[model samples]
Target: MPKVTMNINGRARSTEVENRTLLSTALREKLHLTGTHIGCDTSQCGACVVHVNGKAVKSCAVFAVELDGATIDTIEGQAAPDGSLNVIQQAFKDHHGLQCGFCTPGMVMSAAALLKDNPKPNEAEIRDYLEGNICRCTGYQGIVNAIMAASGQAVPAIAAE
Candidate 1:
């Protein structure tokens, strides 16, 4: 076992984990930040996306030992200190972006990262950016609408048949 220390959600945490322990495991099992979901261990699903040093990375693909001294931000850190939902989260709720909610954390994380880099991305960019995150229930229209609304863009109307 190796001792790894890092800043998680503005708090410094030190834990001993196996050398091969994935960051996702350390976050969920050790640090108790289960909001960072693990959908596909193969990295095909972006459910475990989290910010490492300000860049979103799939936690399932990274070892906890490899991120020593790094600053990690999980879905738990996205809300305000007073517990208010962030803009992206609020948008998701308001736009009905989640159904089963299994993928909401990852979607919100990816959307937050996208909005952080490109505050006003177009519809195509939003879709392209979130291609890695798969949601079986929402069909992604609501997610896209939420991301668009979070960026302050006008959500395009879905025409009636």
Candidate 2:
């Protein structure tokens, strides 16, 4: 087993895992970060999306040992320190971007990452960028609206003190 060290949600963590262990498994099974869902074994579904080194990545496609010393952020890390919803989360709720809510976490994370790179994305850009994340419910309008709304709003900063 190979040992891996990662900063998850600003917390430094280390674990010895099998070489072939997927990041999703490491997050969910080992770290108990169930927010990163395993919707599909293949990388097609973006439910297991997580920020790796500040970029949104499909955790299922990455091996745990390969991410040693990387910074990872899951959906659970997106909320405000007081347990209040972040701007994106509030946008989703305000826009009704989620129906079943199974895909909302991934969608929110992906959108948040997208906004980090492109703060003012248009509708087409939002759709094009979010194509990787598949949502069975709420279609794409609500999600798009949520992202659009969140794009202009400032995200809540995580408290360090």
Candidate 3:
């Protein structure tokens, strides 16, 4: 077993995990950060997305040992210290970006990464950036609107329907 240590959500966390332990598993089972869901172990679902060293990556595809000493940000960290929803999270709620809530954490994480790289992404750009995220509910209209609203852009009445 490898003892992996990571800076998760601005805190140093250490866990003893097997050689084949996936980052998602280490996060959920070891670190007890269950917000990073394991919707697909094959990495196609994008439900395990998290920020590894400031980049959005599907946690299911990465090994926990390989990321030892790296900085990781999960959905648990994407909020104000006072527990207030971050702009992106608030936007998601206001826009109804989630359905069933299985994919909400990853969607929010991906959206945060996109907004970081392209703060004012247009509709087409937002859609393009979200290619990896799979939202089975809300038909992605609310998700798109949430991202736009988070960027301080005007969200069209797309969520009004």
Worst lDDT 10-window in candidate 3: 152-161
TM-score of 3: 0.96
Q: Show the colliding residue pairs in model 3.
A: none
Tens digits of per-residue lDDT for model 3, 1-161: 88999999999999999989999999999988999999968998888999999999999999999998899999999998999999999999998888799999999999999989999999889888889989877458988998999999999874443
Candidate 1 wrongly placed segments (more than 4 Å): 159-161
Give the clashing residue pairs of candidate 2, or none.
none
Q: For candidate 2, give the lDDT of residue 14.
A: 92
Tens-digit lDDT track of model 2 for 19-117: 999999999998889988888779887988999999999999999999999999999999978999999999999877899888887898999899999
| Cα lDDT of model 1 by residue, 81-106, tens digit | 99999999999999888988999999
Rank the models by lDDT, top first. 3, 1, 2
Candidate 1: lDDT over CA atoms? 0.91
Give the range where candidate 1 is weakest over 10 consecutive residues by summed lDDT.
Answer: 152-161
Q: What lDDT score goes with residue 131 in model 3? A: 92
Clashes of 2: 0
